[model samples]
Structure formats: C-alpha cells, structure tokens
Target: MAAEVKLAVRGAGKRYGEMDALKDCSLDVAPNSIVSIVGPSGCGKTTLLWSMSGLHGLTSGEVLLDGRRITGPHPDIGLVFQEANLLPWRNLMDNILFPFEVKHQKPDHGWIAHLLERVGLTGFEKNFPNELSGGMQQRASIVRALSLRPSVLLMDEPFGALDAFTREEMNQLVEEIWMETHTTIVFITHSIEEALFLSDKVVVLTPRPGRVLNTYEVPFERPRTMEIMAGKEVYDLTYRIKADIYGQSRMQARAAE
Candidate 1:
C-alpha cells in the first residue's frame, strides 16, 4: 500500500533581492515514497530543495513536516548533496557517524553497521573515502545521511557526478535502501529517465521564477529495471517531458529578444 503524506511545501516562495527564485511552489510528499523534481537549468530546483531542507527560509509560504512548520534545520530532515562530501581523512565508520557527533546525539553502532551492510560497504568500515570507488564513496555518504534516522531524505543531484555505469549501480542501491527503510525522499535531477525510474511522482518545474509545470504519477511496478526504459510508455513520457522543457526554453528566449 502507498504511504500517507509526511512532508509538504505550501505556496512556498523564495526571493533574492528583486529576483524570485521560486514562486508559489507547493508539493505534498508521502511517507516512504520517492518524489523526483526535474527542470531546466536555473529553474530553482536546488533553491526549492534548500527551502524544503530549512537551510534557507522561504520569503513566502511554508514547509511542513508532520504538520508543523519548518523554521530551520530539524533532526528529522537529512540532506545529501551533489558531491559525496565525505571527509577525506575520516574512515567509513567515522564519516557515517559524523552526523550524530554534530547533533550531539548518541551514536547507534548497530544501526550504522546495518546501513553499511545494506549499502555493500560492510567490511570497508576502516577505509577512507579516498580508498573507496566513486560508487562506494556515494554509498558511504548515503549511509551518513541515513545515520540520522531522518523521516525524510533530501538529495540534490547525488549521482550527477558519476559515470553512466556507476550512476545506474547507485540507482539500484538507492532503490534497495528506499524499499527497506521506507524513508520519504525528495530528489532533484536533470534526467527525465532518472526521475521516472526512481519516483512515485515526478514534478516538472518551469524556468526561473520557478513553478510546477506538471506532476506525473509513475505507473510502473516496483523492482524496476533498465529494460523498462525501452518500453513504449516510458518512451512517450520521456519525449513529452523533453518537448515540454524545450518548448518552454524557446518561449523564454523569444521573450528575452
């Protein structure tokens, strides 16, 4: 069964001086479900995430978690950035436990071990980020985020830096962990295929002064594979989204001339 709504952004807007980065943006995210946000470059995808994370407050509207307002960073929200951002000097174990240390919360070794095993970094606890492969480093970074045991995970282009092959592997890993942990996730990406593959719902945003263009409910069953990308339904959806984004880009250019 699908989960209940756990996070929401209601009429959220953020402005930088005279520029509006996000305007009247709102979304309801379900518990234990994955939502992907996609948009053209400079469309405030990252800005929306920053607002949701409570790293920056919205100039208008609100972000809610469990029905309460998000005034700032909370323990229940965990963020993973585009880079793995692991400390080069810290070993896998130490790096994963870093969040707890900063939060002044007691480290849960058992939970940490479980996450390491789940992400396939079980025996490499002693290895530094430099000692791990790109995929492995990312896995460790995920473990670090999960260590907080946050109800929601916000990921911003987490795999955008990896090669195509490694990115696919990381996708599979994320799928496995999401299923196991039932954590709500809001992921931002430029790839429509990635959005389709990883999301329960996909939100496409318009160009700057960003607003929702459309939201799609992904219909494919779980345990999804790369082969699903080749299906006619997936192809049609991909084509339509690309056309929508391209169409908007041209419109914006024409207006600027």
Candidate 2:
C-alpha cells in the first residue's frame, strides 16, 4: 500500500525434515512502516521472522531487501527477542554497545545517547541487567539492536514477557521510536490488540505450515493514543480479525495460549 517496497518476502516457505513450518508465504514491507504478523500457536511465526533475518534458511523461497537478496544476516537489519538477553556481567551501556564491539566498529556515541534518550534509558547506562527491571532490560535490548541504526528491525514478540502495563508502555515507546527514526519494522505478536495498536497493517498467518492469510489496514490516524483501543472502531476490527484467525479452526486464548 505504501509506495516503494523496502522488503519483500516472495513465495517463501520453510520445512524441517518432515515438518513444514511455512509455505508459500509472501508479503511486502514499505519503508518506515510497521507490519504486525499474528496467528495461532505453532503457526511458524518465529520461523518466518528468522528466515527474513537471513539467520535461518527458507526451504522454498527468498527474502529481498532493497531489491537485493538476503542470503545471510545483513548489517542493515537488527533483531530483538522476547528476553533482553543482556549479559549479567556487563553494565547496561556496554551491553547496548556490544554489537559495535562484535563488528570491531567505532560506535557513534551521539547516536547511542539519542537512542537511550528516546527509549528512556539515558541515566541507567551504568546499571547492569540484574539491577534493572524487566521493562528497563527490554528497553536496553531495543537500544542495543538499534545502536547500529539498522534500516529494518525484525522484532519477535519483544514485549511478550512484560506485565500488561509495562507492555503498553513498551508499545508506546515503540511507536515513538518508529515515528522518530522512521525505521521499517516487522513485528510478530499473538495479541491482536497489540498488533492493531502498533501497526500500519496487521498480517494474519494460517495455522501450522503457516502462509499469509490476509492483511488488514489499520484505519486509525497517526500519533494514536491508548484511548483508541477503547473506541468502537478498534473494538470492531479486533473481532473481525479474530473471526479471520478463528475461522481456520484456531481460536485465541489471552497470553492467548
């Protein structure tokens, strides 16, 4: 829908021995847009995200970024997982800057400071992961992934581990980051509310051996507030998307498992 595709998944699929994880999956991501993928349990959501990262190979298709094929991990892409995965021994700032050390590259301290400020992690730089709360740790993880200023960020349920309040706060933080940086993102989540609240478009995947089912555009305007979720439109769309996911013999449960 948005002009000029930044990332494309073409007839993609992945099979492991006798188990098929994804099949004929295809989608396009326009630059700076947030696309959320949701589906039932074991629907290959993680598999698909991994394939896009080029960290895992697809059995049947390809992923292209900026018209170039992604055969392996690309520097322009970054990932954040459900857990912060921070090192216990390192201070927060060192952990955030770990990627730079791995690449033997000099980090732009200004960029680090800006990202830390954006994520509300500025003064906590000296704290270790053990000293920070879960939300703070996750924020550190986000900043770490973003330290290199990747063009596209692939997030696999990055906020799934937090409490409802903390998750909402992270969602707000994500929206702010996206607006400020205009970084393209493909987020995988099981929460339809979370997906609708944060994405420009919500992508639905079928049950196991997952494939693209449908994509719904979020008609809400930008700079959305939490109040949008309590409104009738989101309420209506939520059920509609649920019907789409449920129609396939799978229903959402809340943690939804």
Task: Write the residue-wise lDDT of candidate 1 on 1-257 in tens digits.
Answer: 85567999899888999999999998899888899999999999999998899999999999999889999998899999888999998998899888888878899889989998898899999998898998888889999999979999999999999998888888888889988888999999998988888999999899988999988888887779767867988888888888889999999899999
Question: How close is every model to the real structure, measured as TM-score?
Answer: 0.95, 0.94
User: Can you tell me which runs of candidate 2 are displaced by over 4 Å?
Assistant: 1-3, 250-257
Off by over 4 Å in 1: 1-4
lDDT of model 1 at position 33? 88
Q: For candidate 1, what is the TM-score?
A: 0.95
lDDT scores of the candidates, listed in order: 0.90, 0.91
TM-score, cand. 2 vs. native: 0.94
Candidate 2 residue 228 Cα shift, in angstroms, is: 2.8
